[model samples]
Target chain A: MNDAFILAGIRDVARKHVGWEGPIEPDMRLVEDLSLDSIKLLTLAIEVENRFQICLDPERDHELITVRDLVAAISHQISDTQKPEEENSHRDTEDTE
Target chain B: MNIASVGSALPPHFYDQETLLAALRANWTQRHHNVDRLEALHRNVLVGGRHLALPIEEYDNLKTWGDSNDAWTRVAQDVGETAILRALEKAGLGVDDVDALIFVTVTGVATPSIDARLMNRLHLPPRVKRMPIFGLGCVAGAAGIARAADYVRAYPDQVAVLLSVELCSLTLQRQDLSIPNLIASGLFGDGAAAAVVVGAERRADGPQVIDSRSIFYPDSEEVMGWDISESGFKIVLSAGVPEVVKHYLGRDVDAFLDDHGLSRSDIRSWVSHPGGPKVLTAMEEALELPDGALDVTWNSLRSVGNLSSTSVLMVLEDTMSDHRPEPGSLGLMLAMGPGFCSELVLLRW
Candidate 1:
């Protein structure tokens, strides 16, 4: 749910799925610095989705260029999906009260 | 030398991308965790469907290299013959007219070679020059055209036919779960294509070869190729392929054009091998092509997947039949393959 957790998830995805043993800094570009091709990026997306159990909108792939961008996107995706359930819970509590 | 015609043949069996992906997932999911990776990889190649040398169910019967290769030889002869005959027919010629026969393929091997075997089937001249080129991989389409051009240039009165038969499905490594093998399983398909090239003195209504160039990058052998083992050919496709294309293709093409008093803007047609989506995108970016410049190539990739050496020839065939450019327009046929090499053939319609 947090940035650190998402960042660590991305690192694992990069290393395990993409075979990148180098350091994955926040500023490192996925294609240029990390050498992730389109296939690698897709693999990373799926692996990250499995790790975090959240669906990533491939439509937003263009906006995710760096490790920081991916971490932020995952965080944002988690928050966006959580908001609906959170709102439903609040509505249910209010009805009960 | 003029390319009088191009003929292509896909096997009788065809399957949509979804079916193919399902088959692959079923095969790989047992050993592979996250079988979704296979799904994503198969879907992202942008191939709508593909043809297999045999029916999908029959592939399971091929349990060894010998078995698959035997199928390759049999089907290759059939498909290759059809392509050659079609090409010759389109050129208004017959088997007796072919002075040179060049056979190119990386998917399988043979002792007497397909060209040699086809002599009895097609009933060609006994003395017809035969050249069986192996291991060019994807570049053999352009490279074969270049070599045929060379032959016709020397003979000046002869006709040359280049046949490329790539049954990529036969070369699949079922046991290997390597990244390259996974990608290859999704990206490549089965097909054969033949190009009829006539000499300068011959009368043919088609694109003429103006010039050709071959460029080999050092220390990049690991970029894209195969690693042959007892099982069969294991693909060695690295993620560095697009990088190689981005780094070299544009500059090499520019220089080749410069030598002939032309530029990128002068080219009206771009007949390129559809390596995959990323390779095509890298080509478009590196060449600074206008939008839709590779529309035909993309269409071919989508319809049949990448046919190895036959891909560019199929693109050329489409260009000739449907997407024909205006008279006096220029075209370039190019492809990159093993040896981490590229072959460029300049043409004029």
Candidate 2:
């Protein structure tokens, strides 16, 4: 998984949702720096999920604060789910051989 | 018609943005899963502090709509009277001088309405005309003044008072975890404002009401309003509010000014109702106003949030007290509210 791509997607969703025109550095705090309120954050979560083809745990939203944190969470979810599927397919191929 | 003087009354219970956010979180955390979202929404409104009609702790015990609105009826009287007295004092007028009373609010309902109640409480003249308006929401402040101006313009010897009292905290729905309710919780504050409009023959010293325009967007009721039910006034706010402003406000202002043989640049000052950041930004863009044209509006939002129908009047009061535009300067006061409509009043100081 490309972390940069995930970061870019998060930035795009944030920009569109909150109208954040400034730069989105990894260190920029969502609440303090960008003024991303709760509704905007929720909208961003849904947008990120749609763009990255990942299901985010709404329950864990409190932990997703910074840009890096959001991107890492999405990347971790994608890798964890995709790796299991890949391993299952490889195991099936080996059994067929 | 002249707005002789304006005054405001805010409850003593004021809290900065963080303390209010913390209180809202403490109340809603158990029922709502998104405390983070609540905090963000509250902070993003950019409201510095607000005056609550009741003490913050008492809000928890408002168990029913009856209890909340009962509080509204009681508090609405107290603040409404205070605001009216201050406005009259500033205008060098008394209750007897007021020929008409226009009370505007949307936070609660009363059978006799606050105007009649005030007339009874203050011993205003029995012949005083009463116009109590409800459900106009934020725009009622400007619209009420416009109507009062109209009243005085017709009767050149009469004086009219527009009083608005909005207890926004009393309308909070504890059970509703919707985004609009959350935004409403942060963006709207409790307060009252009154403006005295004197007829031309009285020769009062104040800005003259040049003209007014009310534009109702047909079939746009769902854009920004309330959906009342057994519980209380549930918010019907939409993201499209800014879109509506961007589309309609510019054309509305241009047509309005052109009708008066003026244009946007000719207006030297603006007394805009600060709905929120988005709406103000949209207003600035739509009207193509220069920098600092809406500073008073942003200052009001930061200080008091949106006081519903009382907001624009509060801004007008601030303008009259602090930022008095030079005499002969052109100004505009405007607000948009539940009717999905805008009220524009042109002024010359």
Candidate 3:
């Protein structure tokens, strides 16, 4: 479900900027398949940051090679950061019960 | 050709360095907590003040990037026309006398381009050739001159005009929190500059166009670039920019001078683009210039920050107004930009 949300966000930006008419999937190459230049990639990164409230370092992250890769990475990051909150909420429910 | 004259026009709105810094700090705080270091970095830029097309409060209301681009176009036309008129008047030439027009900018894009707009506005001849160059960024001024010289070299009886209008303030990214964006906000300002380049065989007035060279550094693409985001144009000014200059400019300058059969010591005047405080310092240290060699560049930076493409032209104008290099004397104009490239123009007065 988180992956879907992240993919939706990336697809929205890519479509707006590059006018991609086809389905956006994991293996889609941002530069080659989507015809996204360096400038467009930067724009996509900015949009992703604003939408997901996540910071991504363009230089450090190597797994974010494709559109699917970006979505997966973001989904992983969001889930990792949210797991503690989910556990805390569960603890609160148990105490209330 | 030697810069016959230079004219600069800033918007009416002006703010003192302290006031600007205060506003910046306030903005930074609103975005992130404890931005003391960012404020200090702003102070270290050595910019005293700058002119803005609109008030700071109005920045938020600039609904779309198109709106800001339109505002830049309006200002560009007004100031660009004024500067070009002054340059032509100083050269004792009319619009009809100009055979070619070169407009340089990186801040905004237009369908007809700024040169086409100016051609129609100024009543330039129908056949007046137009070459509008974009993506050169700050190096456009020196590169514009070099390109103009190339045009005149081929047609030695025709005159060319190079106009640079940089409304960098319009490219401000409201949501960006990067250090480069913050520094760019404090560094670049709005301005336009025009130069009239006449061929040696032409009867018009100006210095002779001696030679020019452009050197592109390898694998240095990350030094500086523009990232076009929805927020606007986000600047990618790497911290290594000053280091790049320090590491390469000395050898590049030597190579440039060597090709012209002259040494750095033989050049009388240096017209360098005032990119920023750090950039100016790096160039100074690398070139080992004497005291006051870069006073014009420094003063231009303090007065107008880095006007991007127009910044070097501002220095060229100041040099012409104050120093007026002696006849047969040598002068060098240098500028660097996005390609991590340097454009050097060797001039003889």
The prediction achieving the highest lDDT against the true structure is: 1
RMSD after Cα superposition, model 3 = 8.6
Sort all candidates by TM-score, best to worst. Answer: 1, 2, 3
**Candidate 3 per-residue lDDT over residues B218-286, each given as its tens digit:** 887877888887756778876566777899988988998997778999988899999887788889999
* Cα error, candidate 3, residue B198 (Å): 0.5
Candidate DockQ values, in order, are 0.15, 0.07, 0.04
* lDDT sort, best first: 1, 2, 3
Off by over 4 Å in 1: A1-97
The lDDT per prediction is 0.92, 0.87, 0.81
DockQ of 2: 0.07
Candidate 2 local lDDT, A1-97, one digit each (tens):
7988888887787776556878888777777787766556776776676667676777788998788888789999899879999999999999999
Q: Kindly give the stretch of ten consecutive residues in candidate 1 chain B with the minimal lDDT sum.
A: B29-38
What TM-score does chain B get in every candidate? Answer: 0.99, 0.98, 0.96
- What is the Cα-based lDDT of residue B144 in candidate 2? 93
Question: What are the per-residue Cα lDDT tens digits for candidate 2 across B1-349?
Answer: 8999998999989988888887878776664544665576678888999999999989888999999999999999999999999999999999999899999999999989999999999999999999988889889999998999999888999999999999999998878766677788899899999999999899777789999999999998867888887889898877767888999999999999999899998999899989999999999999999999999989999998999889889888888989999999999999998768999999999
